[model samples]
Target: MTDPLQDPRFLQDPYPAYARLRDAAPVQRVRTGSDGLHSYLVTGYAEARAAFTDPRLSKDTARFFAGRPSGRELHPAVSQTMLASDPPRHTRLRRLVTKAFTRGSVERLRPYIQEVTDGLLDGWAPGGEADLVEDLAAPLPVTVICQLLGVPEADRAAVRGWSDDLFASGEPARTDAASHALAGYLAWLVAAKRSTPDGSLLHDLVRARDGEDRLTEDELLSLAVLLLVAGHETTTHFIGNAALALLQDPGSLARLLDEPEAFAGALDELLRFDSPVGIATFRYSTEALTLGGTPIPAGVPVLISPGAANRDPVRFAGPDGLDLGRDAGAHLAFGHGIHRCLGAPLARAEGEIALRTLFTRFPRLRLAAPEQEPVRRRTRLMRGLRSLPVTW
Candidate 1:
């Protein structure tokens, strides 16, 4: 009975555990702390993919909690978003902003992204180390996304704070409070954009419509908040985790440095080797479904562990090793089926460019702190170092 939540082994390296689970049983009923809700954790590659695309699986927490007086309430704004909805509305909402993340759209922002990365690197004094998470990884996405959203540069810090408070916390109560604050902040931004829309993603979304269909006030705020949080936090981790991986494997770093173009392949490998969003956004069961030979009764909560599946030996040849040139496209790090991450292309571009800039500029970069002392978060949803102290 491995307690997945508090397992120290899982906290460090979960590959062995995932292999065991994948081999022993496609589905395992993990015991929960008495207080936590009972749920199914999908680990097998095939089963996980099936669970991801299953129509019987629901993302709307409201339907799962219907008539249940569990003192827990899903945030209305969050629950109403496309991420939490099924077809029709989901297709409509997703189509509204899909054009904003096309190849051309993301590529156009590369120069601006490079400038942001360089500005942050320039601020780091020679031989004077700082937390890479703070000085670079954390701020780069903030600047890039803020500019893309047409958010006033002055509001960047405030928006970042709101996003962090909203998503970084593990506790449900705290997350709810942060969600409230985030919703309010987004509402304010919508009003501000009303009077002064500019050439940015947010403004484009404001003007976006399908014939006569347009986003409602709540939909607008919800989508903006989703982009703000999703745009930065995931990219922050991608940059930090990929950099940390390269630092740990100097050979990989050197390879990437020599052939910057190798980033497309290497980035995929890094993502497959160690993903940031360990689990997909929470999925709830709509009907009694058999997953991995286990009966998942209707209304049970489900989480597909992409981190676990990415390292599953059944999926990767050398699952535990970091192969910079591996064909890592099959990994579910960006998820599978219809709900795959919409910002994935942008994230991949940002990661490739950011990693290239990092290694190329600071050729001698190494961890300032001892390897064992590196900071890591205890969060179950997103796996990342809290702070990565490094010096050139």
Candidate 2:
């Protein structure tokens, strides 16, 4: 079967196609790349949840490419991160930074996040139109993450540019250039943090490294790159996708306007309705195994679609429709098991603050062109609006 992932129409609204795929079978093989390679796409809610924990499915990028040379160099910046590893390595690397991202840590930033949201909104001209993505969604998370990561004010813009370029799908050369640029910049930042240690998170890691040598130089730099990029990108798009959905939904918009904090309570449903990351990151079958009753061969890539599975009819009644009051905790917007997103609490806090503040301030906020489909970024694994023009 053909993958509709890159098609313009599918990017606009992929649920309909996703529904058809899930209906056919929870697991189906489809050509997922321009090279005509096939990967098993998991769309069933139960199957996806199970696949996340299945030991037979491995997320080890370095191991997968070890003997088979892809005829290209693997950027250590991209390859050495915990995100692409398995077992003891993934666990060890994750433990290093997990303390800083706990719920308590993220909640402490609510006030600062609110202040940032207000500052961004303060710039919007009253009653005039603006792209929410550029003005609000993108900047809010970027600013907060940069602050926590100790990225200097002057360097943040460059850092964010590199992060954005890292996700520019369909452009391999651009992606490679960005990976190298960000890796180099982060190496400098890490060294600087070591020389003049402060209360920042990076300094803490540097201190940890000095004491026990828990991680290597490559791991340190790779970890920083992963955290910096993953920190903002998801929250940025989460806010964007959620805000755009609410603008298109009058009833939801009015409800949020009346009691903005309700947006926080509705986050699970909001994430379910339109996930920011369309699919979970890389995974491949380590041994031939059955997922959702279909056999997947060893070495074949396996993709789990949170976007599709969140709307599986068996898992959620009327899943396509957005129901703020619905119980959506089971949704897989954040992947299940060990590989679940580390920054989830941070993302939720940012999303809630950003959405609540946006609608509360502009009660009459609306899509500038309700008739036109919003322009969407075409990255293979991410789902987000390129711009969301809105007016009050």
Candidate 3:
């Protein structure tokens, strides 16, 4: 059967489909595209967790397709980054970048995060409608990431345009164009950073590239693009999805508003309820492996759905319901194993500050168009509303 996942409705509310898939089997093969591309989908929590840490499931796409002839080649900017690499290369790149994304480093930005949140919300006058995605969710993370990377304010719009195009679905040509544009911009940015270091994370990366044999010129450029794009994209969706969830449930919203100090704990449950990243990035089998009693052949692609696994009936009681007090710290929203999201700490900090400040500033915040259905982004990789209209 053709994949039901390609349906836009599935993207908007995939929990039902995920429940069906999880109940049917722990792992099932499905055709992902009309191009005859197929992959194994791991839906159960135990199976999904194992798939994430399995050494046989490789992230090195190039190695996975070594002798095969494919119509498209992933841009060096994406292919060479730590996200798409294997160890010792992944080890080297991740080690250098981890220095800037530590819990302490991200925690230090809490004050700045609140300041940015306040500044954004201050622009939206009471009783006037504003798109939460545009005014708050989208710009907040981009501004923080740009500042952290030392990207100039004048250049942020262009950066955002390129990043959006890169993640946009069903636009191969646009995706390629954005990849090249982003790569070219990063190349220039790195060169400019080298001439005049600014103490930003990008500056430190440039130093690593030039001072030691640690990172190559290509790796440096790729890592910068990865940091800029991945740093904000997931967090942007996290804020939007979390807000939408609360808005849909007035009881939850009222409760959250009353307990302002509980935002941190509440954020984890929000992430688990509707994870920003629906599925983990592609992984291929290095050798034939059996998962949940099903044998997957080597060279076949495998996708682990955290969206599905988080709601597994066996894992959490009342998995579908939003429980702010639930211990959801183990959710695979940041993924697992060596390739886990490097910017997770930063994303969490941003989510907590953004949600708390937003609701606190506009306690009467409510959906501007309650009768209208939310328009979700069509991308297969992410699960988020394209826009969230709100007013106080």
What is the C-alpha lDDT profile of model 2 across 79-103, one tens digit per residue?
5688888888788788776754567
Identify the superior model by lDDT, candidate 1 or candidate 3.
3
The total of clashing pairs for model 1 equals 0
What is the alpha-carbon lDDT for the whole of candidate 3? 0.87
Q: Can you tell me which runs of candidate 3 are displaced by over 4 Å?
A: 209-212
Sort the candidates on lDDT, descending order: 3, 2, 1
Clashes of 2: 0
The alpha-carbon lDDT assigned to residue 338 of candidate 3 equals 88
Predict model 1's lDDT versus the native.
0.80
Q: Least accurate stretch of 10 residues (summed lDDT) in model 3?
A: 206-215
lDDT tens digits, residue span 191-310, model 1? 877778777788788888988999988888879878888888888888888888889898988888888777777888999888998767878887898988888888778888898888
Better of 1 and 3 by TM-score: 3
Better-scoring candidate (lDDT), 1 or 2: 2
Every candidate's lDDT: 0.80, 0.87, 0.87
Poorest stretch of ten by lDDT in candidate 1? 30-39
Best lDDT goes to which candidate?
3
Prediction RMSDs, each to the true structure: 1.8, 1.5, 1.5
Taking all chains together, the TM-score of candidate 1 against the true structure is: 0.94
